[model samples]
Target chain A: MTERISFRSAQKKALDIARTRLLVGGALLAAAFLVIGVRLVDVTLFSENGPSRQANARNIAVEKKMDRADIVDRNGILLATGLKTASLYGDPSIIIDPKVAARALVGVLPELSEADVLQKLSSKGEFVWLKRHITPRQKYEVNRLGIPGFEFDEEERRVYPLGRLAVHAIGFTGDDNKGLAGIENSFNTALSERSERVTLSIDVRVQQILRRELAAQIKKFKALGGSGVILDVHTGEVLSLVSLPDFDPHTIKQASRSEKLKEEFKNQQFNRTTLGVYELGSVFKIFNHAIALETGVANMASNYDARKPIRSHGFTISDFHAENRWLTVPEIFMHSSNIGSAKMALDIGVAAQRKFLTDLGLMRRSSIELSEQQQAIFPAPWTELSAMTIAYGHGIAVTPLHAAAAVAAVINGGILYPTTLIRRDELPANGKRVISAQTSADMRKLLRLVVENGTGRNAEAPGYLVGGKTGTAEKPTAGGYKRKALISSFIGAFPMNAPRYVVMAQLDEPKGIKESYGYATGGWTAAPVVSQVISQAAPLLGIAPVDETAPNARRASAIKVATPRARGQGIATN
Target chain B: MKRPATLIIFGLAVFAGAMLFGVAFEVSNLEDRLTGLNKEITRDRDAIHVLRAEWSYLNQPERLDGLSQRHLELRPLEGRQFSDIAALPMRPNRVPTPTTDPVSAETAPAIAALVNAEPGGLPSAETPIATALTAKPKLKPAAPRRPARNVRLASQRISPEATTSTAASDKAALDAALRAIFGNTASNREGASR
Candidate 1:
């Protein structure tokens, strides 16, 4: 095929060859792209392969979604966490021989019976969990069995490593990883939906202190139960809140329902400080003085005719330690005078008294970190007599926390807060206002007087200007107030000139101790407990123990009283 | 004929070079993914380490005991041990102590060669050692309750393990030494529970 070539013809032939080469290259590129398109379609539509997530296409399920956050203390201590645990789950329907698989599984899991395993494996269901919350070791043992149908389902298990220490605040979760109680249940959304830890106000060290003290008191007094709490005056932050009869949140089985947990709650079972509400006794006198002082019904020099009890509705209101003489405002508080308090409330008028209580957050249920809370019981119909009775902490039943909040507002510059459970930043949450600042000052004076000369005298702690009122409310049963059943409690603040902290200690049905001079009233038993608590806590809380001889301390000790005629008229009317 | 051969070799060499470069790029991309995975593991490990440290901090028994002792003068209640606050009579009013600060009067004991002879001569004002000891109790009323007990539990006998200054030094040293020898355990994670 060699043809003799002329110069012009040879050049034209070369150009034609170049054009053919370009056509070939374009055809090859189109064919290659077509092949790739066909393959992509085969994998997307026709393939029987596996899950859609391309990275894990060989696996049965999509990349197992694992999204959970942790709960830690402000100090970075892990309180609650969702840890990824290897759980033993299986494809039941895919098992080739149920009996063989069961035998193999039983060998690995000693707890499982061969018969039981076979029944579960042979079941018509496509999915079954062999064991939940399996350990890494167990997963390894089971995997070695080489059961084709068995597989692992990535699962999240909630763990509270601190157990019962901070259970009420950290809370526990259910199998489906839902919040059940405490912060776990209350702010489940923030804990689960968000990735940040929920830091509670509870200090682990302070909690330990409160728990240990309560436990000791319960044992010493032969009390069936006990509870304790510590609150910051300015912020209303709860440093420590303990309820005896606690349940370990780690193992759900140990903490059955409240019915079971109640039995376990014995000495340390129920959290009496916040959750349990009682008809607290003389402690209510603080509320009455606050109301009186706020309404301008009395001054520090005013006197109340506390010589006789005020009898009404066949019920007598009198001091536990009767002071059968005229008592100045400070004297009435120092003596925990129920009779004097009645007169003071009467002077303030029934409407004003009710308004004061409403302002103190007593008329509602507590809004704390834990969901478990009870509303304080108050008289259904607000009456003049009810006003007088409630003033002395009768005709109304509130939680120890209710007593704590009212006392806190009375001394913390009259700003009332919904006692908190979670630890917050230096700046406190905005709180609701319930009383005036001047009244708070007067209440502080009255509280200090009580510690120095009243029923709370036993509660005085050297150096820490201690002040508070003691409550020993007799439990009202079918046959009037029972002599045996008593709600014994004390609420106190230190450095009363400018208060810092509030500590409330209560012993449920505390029995008389020999050293207590055979008296189980709030003054003898619970007040002394506070003294010990103050002595130990003041230094750690960073309060400088000032000498009582100081003029500032002496000047602040005055307590205002609602004069005598107000008391005489109140008594005669009742 | 020789020129045509040269042209064919040139074409072959260029095609081979391009293929080799493409393969190398693919290998390097795969390696990059692996390195990214290792970095993620390290981040997770660091997070775990921090959480573990926090857990230990919260559970430290000495801290809890100190707080408890201060608030209630209450000891940790074992099942067998329980004492009431009311069991003790109004803590008998303490008799006034006559002393200056006790620390200077009874100088600290030499432990671990921490103390040395004072360079300055002694007395400015004469204060009795007994008075100084008395003053000491008032300064740290809570310390006497169980200072010894805390010392025992903290380090099984506190050696002043590592405070602010030492802790930083120790951590840095350990981190540097480990990083030098191990290349990054996260990068070559060849074991479980490692």
Candidate 2:
């Protein structure tokens, strides 16, 4: 009986131990499941950022991307684009036979030297470049050779499809696709970072016309070189900018390889329209006449004695075609009388002349986007002699672009808008007002008078009513001006009543042709080019031609001038 | 009862596992399609990039200028060629008595019918149209109607013999008229301007 009781107690003790273990295991499992459930809820509904969001963020990285943005003209014609190309590279360590591989490569790419390729392939280095960019057909031909070490590194090459058309504007890229010059250098960061295209203010058709006409004139006159710019007078957008003797952007790569091409490349890279500064002679009279009218020192009826040349400080200021008599303001501008302009400048004083030119944005470096720009060379002390010479555009020198911008300000109601190469949706409201609207109108009348009966008669586009000034500056040398080498330039605006465009053409050292009556002056050379350009570009720009025979058309460009001969004799030459 | 409940739970677990595997496979298949589509898009984009570059090369102004000079009779427009719609002279009230030229002889009956079929039978002297036409004594016979009629007839019928001969004649006449009006075949334009 005692044994049976002991056995029952042992069975109960064993059951009790098993039950305690079961409870401990159940508690542990419940805690683990609760932790997992809480974590799931936090991740799905409560966590601010999660792995799922990170995965989605990664998906966005797979969208289309460009190495560099395209450069287009105002009409969306592609000026510069990035084309996909494969660069040939090799793993020299893996190349079984360097000579055989190099020979095969030279067979496909005739441009590559076999010895050079072999040397590169035989190097101990793990990687070497066989070539930078290869044609697709060459890539295929190389692949067919089944060379072990050969591999293609994908890259994009910058190409200008229009060749040398606008090389000075669009610029070119280097081997690594970095912009080297022109707008490429100016807007490098923006181009590489953004996928959107850069739209320039240039009209390719207008550019073509300007280039063709400038080139033809340069060839005909046997000039050294030429540059031209056509700007929207009101908006300050450059429609066309052409610098002659320009090189194709594609040749830049080859230029580095050959010494002859290097010399040619350096010569062609000089952008004359923006970089080279010259004492643009009579063109400055546009500013002088404008200044005289605006300061109220001279009017259309105002007269100065131009009977004899003014000899001041060992310098004689005389007219190119002297009308040796008392001259009114209109007569001085029309005949380009340097003596009359000097006397007028003397009356206005030096301070006013400097202030007026500064106000016209001609005293400083241009605010254009090009990195190739020059500061205007002006007299530092600005003496009386300087004022007189500057009045006829001698003491001060500026670029053709500066002259263009200043002329635009003069004809565009005396407001100077900052010039730009990028297209603008609206005229900038921050334009500085240099002269009164009345003064601007008076200047237009003077410009028209010059084109009508004076030296700029060659600038007439007939019904288009072109009005401009002729500037024939003797190229300045180290000690004095060279008489034979002249910068013959014409700065003109068409439809004089409401001028829309400012066209400036300049020929460097143009020799006289028989057709020009042995005259290489602005009136003989540059004026005809301007007239042709205006006539051809007017219809393209949607400018309607007015019948000059119509009474209203006659009234639009007409200015009344008092006869200088009737005014009287000389007021005594200084 | 416990046995049957355990059996039901086991069966439900098997169904849920199968559903999980099926959904995972479907997701994988969709991901594969997405990858393929992305690849195709990239290839097509590259092709478009190449084609755009080629197009720009082909459309160079210098090349186009050369091509036009060789293949086309068109020339740059002159200022005198443009005039306001109001400046154009009014249409002539009376058509020129059709010439008995071979092409015109074939269409003379059609033109007579067209002129006679006018709603106002005689076109009186006092009518505004007649007055407008009479204002310009140098107005030429505007023969625009005949070519338009020929185009309409050429499209509507398919008879091989008679229609083919007339169509050929009509085409030649149309070409001459078009060359005179719009095509800058200089000779034709010079005659018309004179």
Candidate 3:
């Protein structure tokens, strides 16, 4: 029995050896499978960038975000820019002492609420915000705190240092680092994503001068609002734009202010030269005469019956200080006779008139680059009454930018181009044609007649050959049009013989000034202001004085058709 | 056996050669990478220099003044001792061109040529046109009836028609004399300011 038991023990030992070998082989096989799986993951996630070789690869450190490109002027003036800023926050989960961190934080940022800070610090959140848009100084102070849980998250913030200057064109950004208003808002994608700098045509100095002059006028007149615009007609570039009762964009405390921000935008929503719509009084008459001449319905000596007020639908169309006689086209423009302009528009025909305005970019929203833009308010049905009122600068509203573009067409040899704020290479110099060259010349002569003798007399700037029109429209009140409250504006293009630039200045509810002899009319106010600005800026603009007296102006003037009575008188005299 | 041992030594030498080849390949790659980094640095430095120079050029205040001078006939600033804004006389109603018609502008009296080389009547289109080409009537800022050739529209608001609308002829006479002293415009206002 002993011999048999010993033999069984030996067999058990042999079986135990086989069991150990199987276990070791299985373990090795499992290790090989695990290695194959990891290698597969490595190939899928990263070839050279995988953890297997990541330590050897280059550019493996922190990535530097190439943030938003800056918007600068042609001369590299910073109109808009983004700066890298650090946002301070805390990991509440790691913060050991809530009271200690709160006390330390409040010391650096007095604006922060200590109770709120402590509450945030004591929260169970993995992350909590401490301060946003922290300046370098505040960052330095926070760094000095050296609190264990405190940290910084890199961020970018847009700041306008000039504040309110060119605010409409430059625009403002929203909280999430996006543009919400102006050029900033409109071109947000280009600015934030693109690496190339976006250059604008604004001359900061010119902008300052325009804003300064407009502001002084606003203050002097004690008006509710004011706007001014200057254009480089040849290039279709806006030199300066102004709208007042401005705001400091650096610090805005209220969200309500942000929505009403357009109102306080100085020239924000009021791109009077490009966006606001108003029946700009007599300024529209320039278009009327041009339309008549271009359509061959009127000549330089054509007569219009404006001897008395034409009372139609309670809109008495008459000239102030009435001539009470049949007036020539030049004389009519000089006198700013609505009755005469209505006649010119009628002769041009409604279809041709609408075509001309549309061609001139007056019947639609302007194509400028700014976000704040509006369509011109025109008669939907476009009735005969609409045509008449539109001819005399009534029954329509348009932005200043639109008017500027149209004015460019009037004096710029009837070439019209949409305004541009962005600086670009190779602009289309010859804009779309809105009228015949001969008609444009006739319009200029008519404009000169107005500045020389009519209501725009104040607009004459010696050698500048300045020609313009003045408009004073009573503001529409809640009940009816306010007889006293008015919107007075002057639009002028200098060196009218071959126009170079268009300048328009407007005063909203301008009070009668002692210097202006207590007259709030456009001639007494807006016209003179624009005339002065033009006269001062002309030589700077490099506009050489042409010898207007050089016998060319008479030749350029259309052949004056004589009246039958005048011809008969000449014959009789002969 | 000794031959087999010698064969083993040669195999060891081949293994060592392969290792050296791998090391050389790594060193060459590192050299290429270093060169690329150096090139990047150089390019960044050049960009910085160009941007700096452009910034300096743009910041030059003379650029604005130059542009302004090109666009406007801005007078050089003078010590108010010589000219005061408050002391200006009330402008005339219509300051049209005193010489409105080119016929009148051309009717200017012929003057003796200043330089022997210049043919004096009206400058030809080829010649550089200057207000100096026309003889100045006065050499002062405040003057009356300056020479028609040199007289531009005065910063004076009075249009030519308004020149006759003055309340007093005596003030006009005094203005005429002051213009005579500064009116020449031959002297560079920019130089004087500088």
Best lDDT among the predictions, by candidate number: 2
Encode model 3's per-residue lDDT on A349-406: one tens digit a residue.
7799899888888877677887677788887888777888888887788776787778
Clashes of 1: 21
- What is model 1's interface RMSD? 12.9
Clashing pairs in 2: none
The DockQ-derived docking category for candidate 3 is: incorrect
All candidates: TM-score of chain A: 0.83, 0.92, 0.82
Compared with the true structure, the alpha-carbon lDDT of candidate 1 equals 0.69
What CAPRI-style quality would you assign to candidate 1?
Answer: incorrect
Which candidate has the highest DockQ of all? Answer: 2
Is candidate 1 or 2 superior in TM-score?
2
Q: What DockQ results do all the predictions give, each relative to the true complex?
A: 0.06, 0.16, 0.04
lDDT at residue B157 of model 1 (Cα atoms) = 14
Off-target runs (Cα >4 Å) in candidate 1 are A1-66, A94-116, A255-271, A426-429, A556-574, B1-54, B57-194
* Higher-ranked by lDDT: 1 or 2: 2
Query: How far in Å is the alpha carbon of B162 misplaced in model 2?
Result: 34
lDDT of 3 by residue, B1-194 (tens): 89999999999999999998998999789868866886686567546634644564464334555687799876632111122211222221122255553312223221111121121234333222222212122213333222232133342322332335444343454464346335656323533676
Displacement of the residue A561 alpha carbon in candidate 1, Å = 9.9
Q: Residue by residue across A169-266, what tens digits does model 1's lDDT show?
A: 67678888898777788888877777556777777666666676667777888776766778887777787777775777756654455785656644
The candidates' interface RMSDs, in order, read: 12.9, 9.5, 9.6
lDDT tens digits, residues B148-171, model 1? 221212222112322223333434
Off by over 4 Å in 2: A1-59, A194-196, A565-574, B1-14, B86-135, B138-194
